[model samples]
Target: MLSMKVLFAHLGREHLGVEYLSAALKRQGHETALALDPGLFGINDNVFHNARLERRFDQTRRVLRALEEQRPDLAAFTVYTSTFPWALRMAREFKRRSPRTPIVFGGLHPTFEPERTLRCRDADFIIRGEGEGALCDLAHALEHGTDPREIPNLGFRADDDSPALNPLRPLIGNLDDLPFPDKGLFERDINFRDDYIVLCSRGCPHRCSYCCENALHRLHGPGWYRRRSAESVLLELEEMKARYRFREVMFNDPILLTHRGWLEELLEGYRRRIRVPFRCFGQPALMTDAMALLLKHSGCQCVEFGMQTVNEDLKRETLGRPETNEQALNAFRICDRHGLPFDIDHMFGLPGECAADHARALDFYKPLRRLNRIKTHQLVYFPGTAITAEAAE
Candidate 1:
């Protein structure tokens, strides 16, 4: 059997999805490499850019250069909405250079907008949702010269040059069965000394209108939200600590406090074995005295909460966030009492937002004693999110 060398192209920060897919492919006896483009000049990850500087330093050229050097059998990319265009540009250039080599795209953007993404002539195939299994299958089929279009969760252009999408495969029930992410892929690019990021869970519980989680939940059904076993998570962290000697750990789960029983068990193990200082996100409505205390005792340096709006009516009706303004305050108060530094994620410019909303947010946050920082962002309407449909209406 041919051992396909799969090249994954990514921009800016290290991507956990790409790492996981690479690990899966390697486990199946396929080789993988990363062509990381440090997206400079406001390409995708960073905010700093000068038009002149950007023109002088087209970072995609660097990625293309890597492509020429590696000349892998397949090129893959994991993309989000913000980085879709960049991914396309890179794909088109790769097609231009090596038309015979196939390109596959996966991740949040393609998971939702598979057809639109495949409309690009250069995009040979896309794997939508939970790609580790599907990608490995696709690679195996491709290496053995088998037809790949029937593979679940894969999308490709039909003989008529139209998008042909296969139904999604069943979601992976136990994340522990999968091998640990291929962190070696990004060792040279990422500063593991600062913080080692780990995703201990898959999918978010809440169906927030602005987020794609709801769409995912709709697609995958009730089991959409799943967490890694506490033992699995601690073992990964223990391995990471031994390898990188990381000063800090970052839980990149959508919300770290999904299951109380799991959280308590994880915290207990974390405190005892992997006691490195860490930070994670939690829903304000999910916070409790016991949970906050456990986090503090477990070496959590901070907790971040999404307090998108102070107006309860807008939050529920528009954002679909079940948490009320009082609940958010209670969460803050609980954190403060436990001496847990916390940050507030603030979003302005909702569809029907006004200056009063901003003022009210300011008033709500002004009195919080343990508020580490208020991270502000303008709301972005992704293509298939409920908020985008409502905004159009």
Candidate 2:
């Protein structure tokens, strides 16, 4: 394939998605540059000529100027619902200045909701599902002048009415084949001096109605969950610990501690090789005494539970998460018994959630002392989740 330069624009939080794509592109001999938004980190004072917003505007101008100078063939964007407006705004501005450039949007927003995304004027193509390989395909196609219509996991604006969405690509079964994200690329805009983030796995296996993972997995076809080797994970941690000297590391995986054997091997490897106190995600049902002890021994300082609600009936009939309240409580108790700090998760503002449900949550929280933090996120209706249809009703 002909060599080409591609630039990635994103808002915040380590820039892992684009960094993986960057590594993939570089692995195939393409040039990649990251143009992260400084506005993402800026606070909003919520007033006219807000200094935070003004500073962000200035950063946007700098980005535009840099892109103009660099003149990359394609400007790929990692977008989310929160970052969509700004991503498109910058994309359109850059397109106005250099109309020949193609703008591709990826990530949770674009992946499941392609039609809504394509309606955005600047969204030229979307690489849905796991973008590492599909992004590489897009870059290669663009570099070699190949027809992009049939590229797997690609959605393109066509000449006719309906947008062209190619067949879904096969999911990456063994995630170890993918390159470790180039942390150096994101270190341009972030300093993880205290926090090291990792993704030892991809795709949560549960089909929680409100979660994007369900739709995302359907988009990937089947066998949605995949994990890297404990050795691979440990090696990456070893390097990051030595290089950044971070005080804490956090697993960004949706649900880690997938199984007893995998968790044991990882815990053993971590204890033997690395010890930078880390945190990870765990499901309430999967949380067990054995796993908690393994986590404690492995320097797992915290475990965040994704228990969307404490109401068992609502969870089963409405949320598609069937774990009992006792299951969740037992999970937390195991961690507490092991002296591992924990975070309890809950979702407020579901379709039928009421004052009683909230009071139930407060009552449930009263006895859970191991709780380092409690995260109560209001339900957001992303376009394609199973909860979306119910939410509309």
Candidate 3:
């Protein structure tokens, strides 16, 4: 089979999805490159032009030039709701210059809403589930002139303008079977390599209505959760250390301490071999004093836990989290006792929330302000998620 050149279009953000896919493609004998889009390349809005704007403009030009120069057989994108417009613009521009090339999109936005995404006309294919195996099959079918409609986890438009949404490929049960993500594909484009991200596991225990993670977990059916052996993770880090100099690591898992046994093994491994400073997510309901102490000893610099609202009804009925306010506060007390720096996440503009509710959330945080930092996000109603349905209701 001929080697295909694949180009991934992404915003200037840490998109581990593309990196993982790049690794898969590399293992299957394809060359992959990343084109990081400069954020806020507003095509219509006239904002005050500054040095920052000029620099962003120049970076966008460089990425577009890569499209013309490389002429990749397939151009892919990792689309987020926030970056969908920018991705569409880039895809249309790429297609305009090289109509023969194909455009494939993956990630939460397209995975949940392929119909809406393919409606763009420029998007040629959508990988609806995990991409490693499914995308490899698609590449093979495309190269061999096979029927891609038969491929799992693939969605495309038919000649009659109807959509073909295929079933998802089976989830990779053993995460260790996967190669270490090709960080080089993204690392070369970014300025700094000090802060790196690695996920030792997939799937979250919680069923948060607004969380795409939980929705995705349901997509793969039961037993979607999987974790890597501590040794497997340590080996990947050892390889990463050999290639690049990194100071801090961020575990991208929804909650790092899923199983106490696994967490202990990972922490023990980190203590013995990979002692880089790290931070990870925690859930108030899952917080334990022993886990906090182990994390502190294992060089945990910070922890982030979602406390989306102080409304107990909203937390339990709407968000699908049942941890009580007292329970949430006690989790922080444990962190404070362990002297572990922690932050809390808040959602201000949720479906049934109002300004008073936001203020009430602040009142709830006031007492804990000395113990943890706070960050708030506007409620994002992603398609196919329970929260989106609730919002519509």
Candidate achieving the largest TM-score: 1
Per-residue error for 74 in candidate 1, Å, reads 0.4
Model 3 TM-score on a 0 to 1 scale: 0.93
What lDDT does the true structure give each of the candidates?
0.88, 0.81, 0.82
- Candidate numbers, best TM-score first, in rank order: 1, 3, 2
What is the per-residue lDDT of model 2 for residues 5-62, given as tens digits with 9 covering 90 to 100?
Answer: 9988766557677777888888899888877665633432212335665565657877
Candidate 3 lDDT over 1-393, as tens digits, reads: 687788888875667788889999899998888787655434322234366664666556777888888878888888877668878988898888999998999888898889988878888999887889877887777777778788888889988987778888789989999998888887766533588788888787778999887788778876777888888988988788667767888888999978898889888988878778998999887788888899999999999999999889888998899999988998888887888989999887766777888788778777763355787676778887888876787
Ranking by lDDT: 1, 3, 2
TM-score of 2: 0.92
Task: Give all TM-scores, in the order shown.
Answer: 0.96, 0.92, 0.93
Better of 1 and 2 by TM-score: 1
- Report clash pairs, candidate 1: none
Once model 2 is optimally superposed onto the true structure by TM-score, how far is the C-alpha of residue 337 displaced, in angstroms? 2.2
lDDT of 1 by residue, 1-393 (tens): 569999999977888888899999999899999898777676463467577776666677779999978999899999889989889989988888999999999988998898899887667899988898888888888899999988999999999989999998899999999899999999988888789999898888789999888878877889988888989989998998899989999999889987789888998998899878999999988899999988998899999999988878888999999888888899999998888999998897887778998998898888888999998777889877888888789
